[model samples]
Target: MDVTVAIDCMGGDHGAVVTVPATRGFLRSHPRAKAVLVGRPEALEQAKGEFGDEFGDRLNFQVAAEVVDMDESPVSAMKNKKDSSMRVAIELVKSGRADAAVSAGNTGALMAISRFVLKMLPDIDRPAIASALPTMKGRSYVLDLGANVDCSAAHLLQFGVMGAMLVAAIEHTDRPTVGLLNIGEEAIKGNEVVKQAGELLRASGLNFVGNVEGDDIYKGASDVVVCDGFVGNVALKTSEGLAQMLASFLREEFGRGLLSKCAALVALPVLKRFKRRVDHRIYNGAVLLGLRGVVVKSHGSADAFAFEQAIYRAAEAASNQLIERIGERMAAMDGVQQA
Candidate 1:
């Protein structure tokens, strides 16, 4: 596997402190993997200082000269900050200097810069950010996670196909089930767009599971859930918030009394595992699907471990040649012929 990852050293909240160590950790585990750290030379030097020779050989540095601010408008950043870290890292992938690009920066800006720098896959109309959600059974993927807010039925159907391909490749789920996120599971429930998308998916010759209600997400009824960015983003955020609230509530209950503390002690290991399973940080990376190259987005607040997972995810995506697979699938589908 050509596991080379380009990381924006200036992308996250903690900047180089997080990126540098995470790169070191990733290289430590993957001796053959290469990491190109992109950002201001001075900051990257200081951050890269922590690793010394361990990452010195496998690591290369690119001076981005600028950064795309988290609050800046996505289009403005793309138009104005041509030399930003986000743009530079994406350029590496486009130029074949790196196999994948990983960033823990502004989601909107990253998407914008990636679209501008690396371009989209041939048959893709718009790129979607696909994230894996760990379910009771295992892991499932949700697509258009805040990438394209308003989507047509065709867009949602395409998302399902791409998402199914992704999970099948990475998660080893052959014939991964696809479902359209809707208000209800019934065939005639949602508005016209969803109804049309559902019909398209069911007839697309893929493993379509019909419609899936929001509440059924964690139940793992489907392996790939497709929706417009607006609905998918709301569901993602709601799940994260609810998980936090429940963990806090459980801890509070454990602190209530001596008997409660004793019970909590007995269940502490199980609770810890549950907390780890539900933490958003544990599932820190999202793939910018439909891009010409692999681009993984890490949460802005991610720490070293989260960054490590992002690196691993990027490596897996690149090794799998996700974009190439998508192109092949599109070529085979007469309706969505490769662009």
Candidate 2:
């Protein structure tokens, strides 16, 4: 199926410098996909020049009047920057011109504008940021990364429902297991809210696998992990920091002396494999689940390669009909409730 993605060319730290090249690279691999580049006409023209006719008609452009600054508050940006690249790109999806939208912009601004433009899915109170994380058993999806800092037990239950449906659509899993992030494995261990969320998950007809701790995330105890935005953001940032620190330490140790350098040369192949396994760029896209339309958020500081991964992820989700699948799952749940 042909998938169309709206690109916010002026959203990230590097703006068109990164997004344009990333879109080109993504199109090279995904021939069935098309991109609508949204940004200033001058910048988009420059990007078009760089690609020449290689992209053919697969790549197009739209002019956006303004740009949203990284430090701007979400509410202020939403109110003041109506024609901003980020908002314009998302608007393409709302207008049925794009199957999905990808932006490496301010997370808050993206979320706020997206919610304002696309609204929420039926039976979905709020949307959550859901992303994949590397795990020993491959990878797992985690939700509420930073969208809703204060989520209710009911909200968490909705996240589990949306996340499981997402995994089922993208990974083709019949019944992906969902785990509630908690202090302990026992059902009664967490705070009242978490305990209540657990109770709901256990009875919600989902593949509830009980509560899992921090260690269980990388251990791959479940296919989906659920938590409020605050905890999820902390966990995500901490993992990123640890990965960077480990890489720095390894570099320092490898250059310690001639002997260490020689050992590093001998182990270069193994080290490369290890780096690929843990590379965050391979998982650059975070889906804003429960939105009426498809929206993807790329890491703001991502480079061309990393941003390309985000585009690839957006195309996959669109082609797989992720939004429709989530609706069907929720509809089934409603049927059970009405029974």
Candidate 3:
């Protein structure tokens, strides 16, 4: 399958420095893939030389007249930066020029521009950000990671539906289990919105697994975890920080003495495996679910390898027809609700 990805080259902290190399790396792995690199002409030209002639045909550029600042308000960016790289990249998807769009830009600005350009999917009132996190059994998908801060019960249910479909489509699971994030596993615990959401999930034909706490995320309690953006973002950042802290502690301990260094040498292979398992770079892409088109958000501070992972994720979603699968699931659920 040929997947064409529109890359916002000037959207991230490193901008072309990171995105250009990542695009080249992504194309190397996905031979049938093409990239539309969106940024200033001079930057693209420089990248073209760096990438050499082998990727000349597969790699293309779209000139973006402006760039949205990282600290700019989403509303202001949407209103003023019409020709920004983020907006232009999303426009490629809206215009059917690309299968998916990838950006490591301002999260709010990306969401705003995506909604304005591609709009929401039918039957979806709002979009949620969904991303995969490593777990004991495997990886679990979580949603609303800083997208919609305040969501209704109905919106949480929608997130559940969208997240379930996403896991099903990408992971090839027939009926992925869905769990509502709460303080306790009991049905009665949590705020009114979560309780209502759990009730809705139970009745909504999803594989509702009752409630899961924060630890359940790493325990692989469910394939999909649903929560409001505020809570989800907190959990996401906390886990990231914890992972970094663990790695730092390990490094410090290993460098403490000659005996520790010897132990590290003997355990190098095991540590490498553990590092690969916990590395956030491998799972850098966050899917903006409920949108009409595929838009992946990479970590703003992502390096070349991390951004490449995001590009790969965007291409994978496009190839799997993630948007179509979500639409079908929502339609079926709507039909059942009406019945």
lDDT of 2 by residue, 1-339 (tens): 499999999988899889988998899998888999999889988988998999788888999999999989999999899999999999999999999999999999999999999999998898999999989997899999988899888899899998998888777788999999999745558899998898888888999999999999999999999999999999999999998999999999999999999999999999999998888998999999999888999999999999999988888888889999888888878854333
lDDT per residue as tens, model 1, 166-271: 8876777788999889886455589999988877787777899898888778899899999999999999999888877887898899999999999999998998
Top lDDT: which candidate number? 2
Write one digit per residue (lDDT tens) for candidate 3, span 1-339. Answer: 588999999978899889988998899988889999998778878877888887767888899888999999999999998999899999999999999999999999999999999999988988999999999999999999988899988899999999998888678788999999999645557988887888888989999999999999999999999999999999999988987888899899998999999999999999999888788898899999999999999999999999999999888888899999888888888854443
- Specify the highest-TM-score model's number: 2
Query: Candidate 1 lDDT (Cα, whole model)?
Result: 0.85
In order of appearance, the predictions have TM-scores of 0.94, 0.96, 0.95
Which runs in model 1 stand beyond 4 Å of their true positions? Answer: 185-188, 257-259, 336-339
Question: How does candidate 1 fare on TM-score?
Answer: 0.94
Error of 1 at 239 (Å): 0.7
Q: Which 10 residues in a row give candidate 3 its minimum summed lDDT?
A: 330-339
Pitting candidate 1 against candidate 2, the one with the higher TM-score is 2
Model 2 spans with C-alpha error above 4 angstroms: 185-188, 335-339
Local distance difference test values of all predictions, in order: 0.85, 0.91, 0.91
